[model samples]
Target: MASTASESKRVVIVTGAAEGIGRGIALRLANDGYNLGLFDLPKAEPNLTAVANEIRTTCGVRVSTVYGDVSQEEDVKRLVDIVVQELGSLYAMIANAGICINRPLHETTAEQSDKLLDINVKGTFYSFKHASIQLIKQGKGGRLVAASSIAGKRGFAEHAMYCASKFAVRGIVQCAALDYGEHGITVNAYAPGACETSLLTGVDEYFSERKGQPKGSYMEVFSAGSALKRIAQPRDVANLVSFFVSDDAAFVTGQTWLVDGGSVFD
Candidate 1:
């Protein structure tokens, strides 16, 4: 498929597009008629390339893949620049690259907390900052989205580090929305619950070991806690992201909306 111009399809940069929810969002946005800038860590180069290939073959959208650590400011700036050079102007950015630490407060070291905050909090800030700068320069409105978790809304037993990072993401989202609203850019986040991703699997494994239960015990517990009695899929969260980057959400900003299968009520 030929590459579409920025005015025709709109271009979006989705960080951590190698797998899981980020992969789902990249595919969903491509299908939504947006050219995609797929970014992920170098360690995930294979999966990231596969995602780009799949999009080109299936969605036929102009998709470009770049590997970088979002925690680094220079890498993020370069990512924004490269995507624009390859796929035309940037219309939106999905800052979905994040990590989790499942340790009690007593065991959580300052080093672990620093790493988590650097990627989760600082990374989102860079994504928002660079994307909004380009959008403002273009003099056209755009979208900025981030990954928050149900952990951000309420505290969990052994998720002090994770919760602090996610809660900080909410603060960044609200403040960015206010700062960039005048430029016609919307900033929002999607807070998902126990989704069927590797991240959640890790959490479940941690809990299972701590409680001396079977492998899937924590997964089952989380599923049962939700009103739907099932864990969420990547596509479910992608659907919410689909709405946020679309014209329908132009009036909506500064929201950390929940998509947790009714697990955590605001």
Candidate 2:
């Protein structure tokens, strides 16, 4: 339902559309006149649909959903297919589905390691692979954006496996950008620091427990490390992604942008 000023609406597929930075990116793209295919875990259908409806009513753009786990390659492949089928074109693919476990490296378990790699690293790989294939096939260069973290820029104490996975995301973006540049597709990432989300709550709790401090005490420590002396909002990250997903960024690729408000310089 893009306005008549444009004859066609560009489409974007956003994974992890249920909450956090994913929801912020989806909403931001909708407001920017993109028809959307909102992807998330099956359990997130209700929340995802609510988000989709809000976009449709408020932005007057077409919005659809695909519920599946991002860890499975087949699931992610089908996700892009559904997006193309439902939305009519795939203009941008934002692989924003990621998870982190906050625990010391020595205490990390194999199960936790596998889960982290599967969802954070492999999930991004699957998304980047399938979306790039579709874009190449379409013969129209497109944007592929993945979620990284400040931890991706450098290692974190209690977030060891999480850091490794995000580092993998950055590597994949760079490699994919190199491989796909000839076809006109660009690959990039958005790395955010602590934000006001459940993910931050998890971080705060982990540090709080290790420091023997109250629940929110450690979050203040995190905020104070940032040059801005404030935590970023999800929208802060989403705004940068909006640029990467736009024609304005067509010439920019193979870059991992820090949305961390000077928390980490790379």
Candidate 3:
């Protein structure tokens, strides 16, 4: 679809739109009548492109794809540049790309830690920076939403790096909110507990193996952590993001809202 074709609609960029939470958020925005710039890794292009097409067909919204890594500044810059140039104005950016590898603090390798931080922490920082720049340029209010985690609000054993990265996300959201509020920009984060996504498969397996239980037992362990006794769905996270980017949340900024079925008290 032509970028200008959707110019009349508010455009939002969703990184990691190929699957999981990113996909849910993208579709939700499209359903809400916003144009989209969907992005994911080059390896995920086929899936990302397919998702873009589906959103365009089902939601009847303009959808474009930007295949690149979020951890790199240059890639993020190019991604944002393409969004503004192609999709027109960028009113919101959802930095939802993330990965989690379950490893104990002592067993966590330097390489693994670096990779997680580069993608989870630096990638989020890049999204907030570039999105804020575009919003400031537009001279209109905008939303900067990110994915934090229960690990962000509180530390967990064997999740040092992940906790640290998510904590940084919350910190960035608060700082960016304060720094950009004068310009009518709001920054916030959605911190979900255990969600039903491929991202949690490794963690679930690790716990099950440790307990000598079957595959599904780990999911139960996570559910028990929540007061509601259930894991969150991707759509739950997407719904919280929808609120963050909506006009209803204009007064809300610099806050990290937890969507973990009462798992983490926030």
Candidate 4:
């Protein structure tokens, strides 16, 4: 059993907490003294458990792990309920669970696009809705953060539907920010460029094959395109999320920040 929440420490829910950027954010927030409610799909049980245990032992912060698909409204609602029940109060929600598919627009099918939108767009919507409801009930100001890629800001080749879904996420964030501002809930998104994650690995593989280049050649090209002349690490993105959820950004909302090493200048 986990310890009860300390009033001094805030509690947050991070979806897709098993791996990649989600895992990075979880570890960073735990170290920052935030109790965590980590959510991910059932297939990610092993990685999720490991992250939970690591945080418990190292950060000594209370953590509650829940397995569910974010695309389901019931699952998201239950996730919020359980997290509050176990961790005490919900201070913020990080809707980082999303999927990507790399394929040309012409070759993309309805099924592929639907699945991508279901998880990336619909999943984000559900997370925002439930988290907002919980925060309003508590009558405490909170943060709502979601994953929006640089693709959400600009179109990329072979990322048709994926871009569409992320674009929708930005719209949702902006709208939610307006709707929830009066309730003291801030909404925003973090848009990462070519990050070193499994999602980028898939993008790397797709371009490598399409271009007939070596395995890592496309990744090198992606790295060079950024102003930093390198790719972003998971921790890099996590840092932005930390600031967004902190008191430092209480007045900042309805904006999608690009943490892409200056890849897409907005």
- TM-score of model 4 (CA atoms): 0.97
> Mind giving the per-residue lDDT tens digits that candidate 4 earns over 64-97?
9999999899999999999999978899999999
State which candidate, 2 or 3, has the greater lDDT.
3
Question: What are the models' TM-scores?
Answer: 0.97, 0.96, 0.95, 0.97
C-alpha RMSD of each candidate structure in angstroms: 2.3, 1.9, 2.9, 2.8
Per-residue CA lDDT of model 1 for 80-110, tens digit only, reads 9999999879889999999998899999999
Pairs that collide, model 1: none
lDDT of each: 0.92, 0.89, 0.89, 0.93
Candidate 2 residue spans exceeding 4 A from truth:
1-7
**Top-lDDT candidate index:** 4
Error of 4 at 69 (Å): 0.6
- Candidate 3 scores a C-alpha RMSD against the true structure in Å of 2.9
Q: Which segments of model 3 are wrong by more than 4 Å?
A: 1-8
To one decimal, what is the Cα RMSD in angstroms of model 1 from the true structure? 2.3
lDDT of 3 at 123: 96
Please give the ranking of all candidate structures by TM-score, highest first, separated by commas: 1, 4, 2, 3
How does model 1 fare in lDDT? 0.92
lDDT of 2 by residue, 1-266 (tens): 22321356888899998999999998888888888889998888889989998998998989889989999999999999988998788878999998879888899999999999999999999998899889999997888999999889998788899999999999999999999999999899999998888888987887888899999986787689989998889999999998998777879999999988778878
TM-score of model number 2: 0.96
